[model samples]
Target chain A: MTPALDPVIHPIQRLRICALLDPVTEEEFAALRDLLETSDSALSKQLSALAGAGYASQRRATRGGRSRVWVQLTPAGRRAFHGHVAALTALANHAGDPD
Target chain B: MESDAVSAREALDAVSAARELNAERLRRPKRYWIMLGLMLAVFALLPYTADWPPLLRYSAAPALMILVAVVAAWRQPTAVRKIRLSGRMGLQLVGFALLGGVVIAVSRGVHLEQGWWWAPLVAAVLLFAFVAGVGPRMDRSWARRASHGEE
Candidate 1:
């Protein structure tokens, strides 16, 4: 089987979320929604998946008289992302080897 | 037969994507282990007979860096999830930097009387400060990621 077959993070949106999140410590809610090109509902769904898996954290705060939200990888999230990527790489490697 | 064919195609695509992601995850651990192993090996070569002060100074960096890296490797992402700008940790980190700087200056003023042993300590503190201060701001996208749970 390809390394991507079994992953700590599976869903495409969730993986995309991790991809965007892996680089920075935290990111803005609306800004990310724009980048992901996903609706608020779609993004929320993916975020919930990650949060439920203990891979990320979310917080709600207010600024400039408006509600704001933020998200970041927890230590566990980082580990999981790292593992997921590893799983992906392994799959890729296996495909090429074919031995 | 069209629906059946479509189902098979979807399964194939899903499997391929999963493989790709898993492969990427392995890269980090592989690099970490190789680097860590090399460092451990190099440290083992330091003469057992070196002077205490110099040894302490020299050992400070590699020892601490390796220790920190290992600890970070071991930490699940959940462990650092709650990092926040609480006044206490912020103050403590700032305090550490201030203390290190003051000592470094004082030692220099003493005509280098104090072995620059604390330099490595300061570097470590600086590294930690950068991570603590900058890490959160950089990965802010996780907010959206976490909220967009599953579809």
Candidate 2:
């Protein structure tokens, strides 16, 4: 089956977010921000978009006497992200095929 | 159409770069492995405690295990990304447990029959060596596989 591109994850920042979150159980928000090299508000905005789409979730926890936010891709979000990647792969691979 | 394809290729490259970055970030520091190895070593020596008071023998290992876990969690760096264990890592852990168990059992048997009191010591050293040597490598391998979206 041809994978469909997920509208919610199509943007570059959100795509990067999903890619970063894909391998981990969960990531600290600060870590994700650093990895993406984006401002906290920018990251939070993208995360909110994902959360609204049911593709991600975040929670706050206090560890070592400091409060921090952790984020993870929901199962639905993972499926959507994979599908988007597959669709992109298909599109890219089609470039070399005979017209 | 050609432009679309080019953009898609670029997007794919971005995905690859992101995954690579995540893989690099997922590596645990050497300290984590050292602590883990020490914990395993202690667990390896648990069999030698069998002759102690029943309360001490049974509770000590579990308590040590909990303490190590708490310390590890507390020390986890908030700036580094963490990866869930892959199937290969899980299998590696199970294999380590089985091997450790066999070694400890054999060491206990040897101590009983030959009075080789240092058998548990030998087992602990061997297990610690195995863990310290292989733990980091295994973590790196799993990080790579996981970032690349492999099982």
Candidate 3:
């Protein structure tokens, strides 16, 4: 077995962030906030943590002189998201199997 | 693409599980048959006399299917759960569906006829089989293992 490459995908919120971002090109802060059901400060904190881990990327854009915070997955983040998912699945399967 | 390049490994590793079971799994729709029937009927109603043809109509069925799959599957599940297919698979399936349509439309002509009837359905069935066939093996393996705290 490959030892099932499991990365520490910390804090449920950050995990959710990676999950949502894994498939999206880029998502608005508000949309992510809605999905994660977390406050702005909390979401930002998780996002920043993910950014530091190189699992995610954050860009601040000013449109019409208003700041826009965009959250996206780095390729690493996407893979981590997938791997995280796979490990979870593996766990699920193990639990479900009668054998 | 630099940023894209960096996270490629994680993306691959993460969705590898999804890819493994992607095609085999499907979401139950609110009105799946109704949706398919409506799409086919709408495509049928389109004027085939036009130059652009009615490829879009034929193409709509799979598109709607993919859309529904995305919406239904779009959610965050705690407990380290893997997403069913995630976003990448959805986009790929869309492209695949479009490719199927283009090939059929070009070969069979845009008119609603039975020229390439088996192609799309066969393709779908084959894909479904590919996914479904692998299900048992996977069930016996990692998915089962994971559930038992083997991970």
Candidate 4:
């Protein structure tokens, strides 16, 4: 079966976000922002896009009387991300092929 | 779009590199194991505190664990996101919990405290096996998965 690329995760920022979230069960929003080196609004925009596509989810909780957000990929998100990666691998493998 | 500009291979490599970087940077330090070691030491020494006040002896383990957790958290704030116990590591933990429980039950049932120091010895051995053996191996396996884009 062929793996299809997911347009939702095609952007570099979203792709990197998915890659980071792929291994972890959950990630703090602040930590993710720091790791991605993106502004809060930029990260939020990407997260919301993924979430709207049912590709991610976020939770808000209070820690030390301060609110914190944690994000994670959904099962659909994992499938889509892996599918996209597989598609990319396939493309990469054939990129230099001689016709 | 930027995706159109970057070759598929380059994008894949970038993603893989990011994954590896995250795995390497976010992994728990040896201090995490040290905290575990300290906790085990507390448990191992608990039974020997026969002369201490009952209240202090009973509460010591939880208190020490809390302190260790706080210190470990402070020392490694990244720990809050990384160091997840999953897959083989998760199974190993379940096995450890079950075996540890059985050992405790057997130790108390047989009254080995009178002459045999089997409980502490077994605890130490299991702790060593986990820290020195299974734990690192599990981390390696998890890192491989992370780098390879495995779920």
Candidate 5:
């Protein structure tokens, strides 16, 4: 199949979020923010956008006597992220092709 | 077009770095493996405790197993979002079980308690060694697979 870029994941921050989330079963919200070096509000906005697109979801859980938000990609989100990566790889590889 | 390609390549590099970082974050501490290895060693030695009273022999292994589980949960790192055993780890566990079973069966066949009471003890020691030696490598392999989106 011809790979196509996903608009939802095309933005740099959102794409980075998906890249980080794709590896693990779930990640704590604060950890994600720390890794991405983005503020809570900005990370939340990006996550909300991904969640709105049905690509990601978050849940609140109490751990170590504190409430923490955990985020994970939905199955659809994983597929979309992988597809988006494949599209990017294709585009990058095409750079070597002759006109 | 050239600039777009450069950016795409850069983005892919970012993805690779993210995966590597995630894998590193998922790596467990040495203490975790030591505790786990000790627990597993005790579990392997349970069969040798058959001569003990029924209550002690039957309950000890299960109780220790539960304690291990509780400790593991309590000490789970925040970086480890969730524990999903990869196929390789699962296979390693199955292999451990099979090898353990063989040790028990051989010990029984030779009536280890007669003059070779140390057979099971040796087996338990070997099992502990296996865990201590191979556990970290298995964890590394699992982390790599998970980070690469292969799990």
Candidate 6:
């Protein structure tokens, strides 16, 4: 049987974001944005979606007189991300095989 | 590319790439190994200096430790601002504590029985093994664990 993929996390941008956050405990918002090569508003929008779904969390703090935001994946998010990756791998593995 | 256009193959690639990136960032810098080597050198040599004045011999190790701490602080970032997902740091702390405790116990017991003339040589060999072999192997293992989503 094929594994079920998470539709919510199946989007390219969301998949990339989840992939990036899955490894680190937390990442700086600006760094994620730069890495994703997306604008502030766009990244915020995606983060908002993930937050709404309880897949990610964010915190704001002031450092060196500058406010910074950091983002991290929740436990639920990690499980979901790993599961999605597993599904992806399963799909890729079967890409050339007969049913 | 549109979200709908992304295939499972591409998603897998992205995950692999991201893991690689984090592995690189989370890796201890080369200077970290160098500092560890210097610290081990100081520790390994201290056991052999049993003939010096008690105060001077005892003070030398602490002084070197303070120097290493000061240098690490001065060179490394004060606040990394990033969360470390790997358990390597915790493992290193535990490993060092256990190793130090055992080494001190053995060296002191041997010194009481006779002269622990071979303490320094044993320590040097053990530290060489740890730094050149155990350390990198542990790092790679932890990095693999971290990359696999095991925090």
Superposed on all Cα atoms, the candidates' RMSDs to the truth, in angstroms, are 15.5, 3.1, 12.9, 3.6, 3.1, 4.5
TM-score to true structure, per model: 0.40, 0.86, 0.41, 0.81, 0.83, 0.72
| Fnat by candidate, in order | 0.00, 0.85, 0.00, 0.50, 0.75, 0.71
Candidate 5, which segments miss by more than 4 Å at Cα?
Answer: B53-89, B104-115
Against the native chain B, each candidate's TM-score is 0.32, 0.78, 0.28, 0.67, 0.73, 0.66
- Residue A19 of model 3 has an lDDT of 54
Which numbered prediction scores highest in DockQ against the true structure?
Answer: 2
Q: Measured against the native two-chain assembly using Cα atoms, what DockQ does each of the candidate structures obtain, in the order listed? A: 0.03, 0.72, 0.08, 0.47, 0.67, 0.44
Predicted complex 1: CAPRI docking category: incorrect
lDDT of 2 by residue, A1-99 (tens): 778778899998999999999999898899889888899999999999999999999999997799999999999999999999999999888887997
Binned by DockQ into CAPRI classes (incorrect, acceptable, medium, high), candidate 5 is: medium
Stretches > 4 Å off in candidate 3: A2-7, B1-151
Q: Give the least accurate 10-residue stretch of model 3 chain B, judged by summed lDDT.
A: B21-30
Docking class of 4: acceptable
- lDDT for each residue of candidate 1 in B61-122, tens digit (9 for 90 to 100): 57766775676567443223322333444565487556545544553444335455544344
lDDT of 4 at A18: 90
Clashing pairs in 2: none
At residue A26, what lDDT does model 5 achieve? 86
In candidate 5, which residue pairs get closer than 3 Å at backbone N, Cα or C atoms, i.e. clash? Answer: none
Which candidate do you rate higher for DockQ, 4 or 5? 5
Q: Put down candidate 2 lDDT per residue, B1-151, tens digits, no spaces.
A: 7897887888888899999887787877776776777787787787678779999999998898778767766856532446777777789879877887888788878987988889888988887787778878987887899999888
lDDT, model 4, position B118: 62
lDDT for each residue of candidate 4 in A32-69, tens digit (9 for 90 to 100): 89988889999999999999999999999997899999
Instruction: Give the worst 10-residue stretch by lDDT in candidate 1 chain B.
Output: B142-151
